[model samples]
Target: MSKTEKISELKTNKTRKVAFMFNDELWQLFKQTCETNKTKPTWEIEKWILNYLDKNNALD
Candidate 1:
């Protein structure tokens, strides 16, 4: 499949919600990081958590 097709396929999968809590200072830091990286902090953090879980095989 092409990149667009693969992305569309992924988009069709069910997504789960994950909530995070951080102090105001940490939140500001996260916002700055997101702005510098030109991406949503939440999405970046979620991807990081998923990668960590996959690497450790902890999701099972």
Candidate 2:
């Protein structure tokens, strides 16, 4: 499938893109670590957010 098609599918699945600003060095290290662990940065961030919400009883 085409890249555009894949992106469209993601959008249709109710996923939204999020952007963040981070220290360059920290961002690089985090990305590299995730790569080394065979994981995506988004997955890690999602897990962290979910845990934070759950801990604070803020989940919907």
Candidate 1: Cα lDDT at 5: 65
Give the C-alpha miss distance for residue 29 in model 1, angstroms.
0.8
lDDT tens per residue, model 2, 1-60: 654564445435755777899999999999999999999988788768657765775543
State candidate 2's TM-score: 0.70
> On residues 1-60, what C-alpha lDDT tens digit does candidate 1 reach at each position?
654564445445648766778899999998999999899986677578667765786554
**Which window of ten consecutive residues has the lowest lDDT sum in model 1?**
2-11
Q: For candidate 2, give the lDDT.
A: 0.74
Please list all clashing residue pairs in model 1, or write none if there are none.
Answer: none
* Candidate 1 TM-score over all chains jointly: 0.59
What overall lDDT goes with each candidate model?
0.71, 0.74
- The best candidate in terms of lDDT: 2
Candidate closest to the true structure, highest TM-score: 2
